[model samples]
Target: MKFLFIAQRKLVILRNQDFKDINPERQIEITRHFGPIHIHPTSGECQGGSPSSR
Candidate 1:
């Protein structure tokens, strides 16, 4: 069995704008969609993967 994990940095851009930070609403939306994104520092040691046929 294989589980797909996607990892990417979170960023916010303001083109030709004067905003110093991302909008709260947009941040919330992003978090809602892509939040809880975690990674297994050690692939086999992490508990995120499926059970193996030991």
Candidate 2:
């Protein structure tokens, strides 16, 4: 699986093949430290609504 992080107008990509090895709760905990996050689809569209703040 792939995760994209947008911080300070820069993009960072995180890729992991073993998705089950990572805990979902821990992922959320770590991502929240980066401030607000906008989750986009692999297609790179923002969809609707606003970005979520941590």
Candidate 3:
């Protein structure tokens, strides 16, 4: 699942999962294809001035 990777990138990595060491910008590029990324409520503004969905 795509969400698993996104969450893993922030939280913990599970055994047997392929880990990617990507920069934030590159991460966005990869994830954008899955649709808009979710930002935390307190994270403030994201790329292009888009506010957090929360």
Error of 2 at 15 (Å): 9.8
TM-score of each: 0.25, 0.36, 0.39
Question: What does candidate 1's lDDT look like per residue over 1-54, in tens digits?
Answer: 112222243454446964347654454445456555443556553233322311
- The C-alpha lDDT values of all candidates are 0.43, 0.53, 0.60
True-structure lDDT of candidate 1:
0.43
Evaluate model 2: give its TM-score.
0.36
> Any runs in candidate 1 off by more than 4 Å, and if so which?
1-20, 35-54
Q: By descending lDDT, how would the candidates be arranged?
A: 3, 2, 1
Identify the runs in model 2 with alpha carbons over 4 angstroms from their true place: 1-9, 13-20, 41-54
Q: For candidate 3, what is the lDDT?
A: 0.60
Instruction: Name the candidate, 1 or 3, with the larger lDDT value.
Output: 3
Q: How displaced is residue 12 in candidate 1, in Å? A: 17
Leading candidate by lDDT: 3
**Tens-digit lDDT track for model 3 on 4-47?**
87787764345774426654566667667767777777777644
In candidate 3, the residue pairs with backbone N, CA or C atoms under 3 Å apart (3 or more residues apart, or in different chains) clash, namely none
TM-score of 3: 0.39
Question: What lDDT is reached at residue 8 by model 2?
Answer: 54
